[model samples]
Target: MGKPVLIIISGHPATGKTTFGKMISEELKIPLVSPDGIKEILWDNIGWKHDFTEWSNVGKVSFELMYYFIETCLAQGKSLVAEAHFHPEINNARLNALKDKYGCKLLQVHCKADKSVIEERFRQRMASDNFHPGHRHGIVEVYGEEKFYDKLGKGEKLLNIDGEVYEVDTTNAENIDSNKVLEFIKSNL
Candidate 1:
């Protein structure tokens, strides 16, 4: 068996991080750790208010759970893909510490898209009934559309970790080079 690998998929909202991460995880047969998935579970069981502070707190807990799961997998010498809107200032140190402790190979796939596309996608997501209520209420309803759009327009803040970085332009989902992405992951691992 080879060394364990951590494939981190990160980007701003509506950048297709989750979609790309899911593809990678499926193709590579790696377990996926997603904070949003955890947050949805929490919202389902514990309940949530349509308030920013409440949503933020739930998000924090989701991150904690994601870290715990990642560490557990690493401890067992397992490779996995983790997807999140990772803040550099907050997550870089934590990820570095995990890498050091587990001696795992790290790789990051940073997804990016045009700002206008992101705004449109985000709006579509917000309006879609299929999406989790937490996102619709917590993000736009609580934070307001202008503030949320402003945040999205600021672009992604990627984690500062020593790793091979693959940037994917997701402006047009149909245009993403899945074969190239798979090749990058295969080469790294």
Candidate 2:
């Protein structure tokens, strides 16, 4: 058996993290744990409000659930891919601790795109009917354009951790080759 691997798909919002992470998870045959996925479930079951505070609280719960799932998988010696807009100050320590405790190989795939492209993508997603209402309310209605973009601009870097980092240019998501990403993971693991 090989070492358990934790593939972290991280970046600012609307950088194609979810789409790319899904590809990695499918190719690697590992579970994909994402906060937004959990949050959607929580919204469906427990309900959500259009207010910022309610959205923020639900988001925190989603992260907690995501970490619980990650810890459980690692404890069982299973590999998984976790996708999120992870902040260094909030998530780096916890992720590093998990890596050390479980002796898992950590690989961070940080997606990047031009600011303008990201902004446009985010706007489109927010406007889409399929997008979760909680997100549209929290990000667009509450945070507004300026604050949201400012936060996104600040989070364009990787988490502070000891790991193999692979950066993907997602300015054009169609240009991303999943096979190459899988090759990188295979070589690292």
Candidate 3:
């Protein structure tokens, strides 16, 4: 009986964005919008990374589907929990445009852990995810927070889109618990 919410989770790969998004979505009883999972679904239907250069349409197709999926979710008057890097300008632009067009609110969560912690987590996750058909070992996963900070330096948009953001760095003693993230989300909502 409340207005719909659009909660977007954005961060670098292997930063546990999806996991956190899933948790928050379940906690808030909102539907989730997962672009990465979409990639997995369409993996066999399109080109893999090795073929990225050859078939530019592959990326376009993925984006288009993601767009449609978000639109559908919003039209249903349901809140959404979306996970993605969103470091890319293109993705930001798309979300910004869609926000205006659909009148959807966006809650951006930047999940952080120490660089070393992320790398170790990446190695652990890669043991399984690397074998996933659409996955490969990316340098960002190996570098973690360092790579994220570097991207921020290189001018990736750390947008407070819709003026809502929940920043969490597990390295900090204060954020050692997920309560910080939940509190931020509650305040924003």
Candidate 4:
């Protein structure tokens, strides 16, 4: 089988990673695998009684399920787009290892947005029913708004990747140009 393409759309919360992933998935016509989406499903299926305190455990399971999905896709010679707020130190290494194991072409899309814009978007999401429980009920519930903002203010430090990277700035949400990102992925593929 030919090597598959694995596109990673990653960034801090509210940076529009999911939106980018969706656009890329549609353009590439491949599955979109989201750890947060998987976590939501796990929360709904496993119940949220331990969500706040056991979120790490829940996240671990969700990541496991995500990799399972990736492995299945690789075995089928199917490409995929995965969206997440990946930890630079850890998840990047894992992704690299997976690329080696599956011989898949890896393209990383790093997303960023203005802090104030991200915070506003985050607040709006928290007020909405669509807010991820893992964020609203887990992280925010434990850290509170003030602390959450403090950490977010420090900002996310992205790790370096070996291959091509496309940076997308979504500060002006109305002006996000997904075509650029798609073109980069298609060119890399």
| Most accurate candidate by lDDT | 1
Model 3 CA lDDT for position 59: 45
Colliding residue pairs in candidate 1:
none
Write down the TM-score for model 4.
0.90
Tens digit per residue, CA lDDT, model 3, 1-189: 254567777765556687788888888887776756776667666545544343345446656776787788878776677776665556767777767877777778877666666566656665674545455422233334355445432334355565487776654444456777777777766
Q: Which residue pairs overlap in candidate 3's backbone? A: none
CA lDDT, candidate 3, residue 100: 83
Instruction: Indicate the worst ten consecutive residues by lDDT in candidate 4.
Output: 153-162
- Report how far off residue 151 is in candidate 2 (Å): 3.1
lDDT of 1 by residue, 50-156 (tens): 46777788989899999999999999999999999999989999998899999998899998888999899988988888889877777757778777788884744
Question: For each candidate, how many residue pairs have backbone atoms clashing (under 3 Å)?
Answer: 0, 0, 0, 0
Top model number, TM-score: 1
Rate residue 96 of model 1 by lDDT: 89
Question: What residue runs in model 3 are displaced by over 4 Å at the alpha carbon?
Answer: 44-50, 54-60, 129-131, 137-157, 171-175
Question: Candidate 4: lDDT over CA atoms?
Answer: 0.80
Give all candidates' CA lDDT scores.
0.88, 0.85, 0.64, 0.80
2 or 4, which is superior by TM-score? 2
Write one digit per residue (lDDT tens) for candidate 4, span 6-97: 88888888888888888888877899998888888887887755634587787777778888998899878889987877888878788888
